[model samples]
Target: MTRRQAITATATLGLALLLLAMGAAARPLLVDEHPLSRPVLNPTEIGFAQDMLAHHSQALIMTARLDQTADPTVVALADRIEATQREEIGELKGWLRMAGASTVNNAPMQWMHPNNSVTDHHHHAATPSETADGGPAMPGMATQTELDALSAARGTDAARSFLHMMTRHHYGGIQMAQAANNLLTDGIVKQTARDMMTNQTQEAALMEIMLNSLTTAR
Candidate 1:
């Protein structure tokens, strides 16, 4: 081949190699390092965090009243509930914040039944619980009257009331956690929800056993 032909062919090959290298380097920047990239979470995850926070808050309130009971078993159970739930609440809040989600939501449980904008009468599905003044209600929450009653009870009565209320509360919590397990894409959030469901289910069973004991004694 002529020197000129050899030089031109070498130049063409070098330019092609450089172009390929540039594209290779730019590929990741275009796909992974885009400035608009943000963590994606669905509505179900957001609702779970928001609803569970409210649910755990009520659990804390109930557990705080454990001092009114003379039962050591009851008090110990309450202490465990308070401590575990507080930590879980923190985790939920952290996950929500990291995902750029707000714990504050205008409509509660919408993700549980996304299709049903109105309140429906299904066991698994939930509609938003609204008050006369339009305040949202947490599922399985005790009324103020019930709270006052629980506060006034002593001995076995307090123990029994707490067990009854808490068991119901945990059922609601398990439902929410199960929904989260099904919905959330994030591994941390999904695993957290699974742990919650398992823990709360066992706790609820224990509470029922204790409640039955109290009943049998009377």
Candidate 2:
């Protein structure tokens, strides 16, 4: 309308734009730009991944040692177990790598008991074969002697030994997975743990039934 009025309106718009720009500048930047914002695994997640990797590795070893002449059902179960564990191992390793964590853990099973609190019945004093981090041997892990026995056995004996050992192994894995699932609030790792618990629990039950049938057939 008037020149003075137009000038006043223009100044007010400029001031509003300046305030908006300042507000945007004051906001926090994206976390991707910060070093601390990089993906970090909590102690529980790191421990689960590392220990489970070791556990799954042993399962592979057991499957590799299985006698080819064993029962077809037993052989098939071993193959399935190997395949599942191998895929999970890859995922665990990927997560660990993304977090810049070591794939191998010297101190195992610490995640189950934070702050020296141990209430699990499965916890046992460390044996000479598996003493790590001043803690007990991981539950359900076969001793070297047992593994050697399984390696030496053949045919039905091999299947029986494998079924027994793997059943126990699955039990241990279920325990660890359950613990991880409980400890983690919510994340990919937690979901992975829950899946492991379900899968391993079912496997263990099947193994038990197989073992019973094998024994009865003998």
Cα error, residue 69 of model 2, in Å, equals 0.5
Pairs in steric clash, model 2 = none
- Which ten contiguous residues of candidate 1 have the minimum total lDDT? 124-133
lDDT of 1 by residue, 1-218 (tens): 99999999999999999999999999997886657755555667778788888889878988877555458998899999999999988987887888788877666777776777636525432422332333345566666666677888788888988999889889888988887787776666688889999999999999999999989999
Whole-model lDDT per candidate: 0.79, 0.85
* Residue-by-residue lDDT tens digits, candidate 2, 106-202: 6677787876644433455533235433323577777777778888999999999999999988888898899999898998999999999999999
Measured by lDDT, the strongest candidate is 2
lDDT of 2 at 21: 92
**Cα displacement (Å) at residue 96, model 2:** 0.3
- Which parts of model 2 are misplaced by more than 4 Å? 1-38, 117-122, 126-136
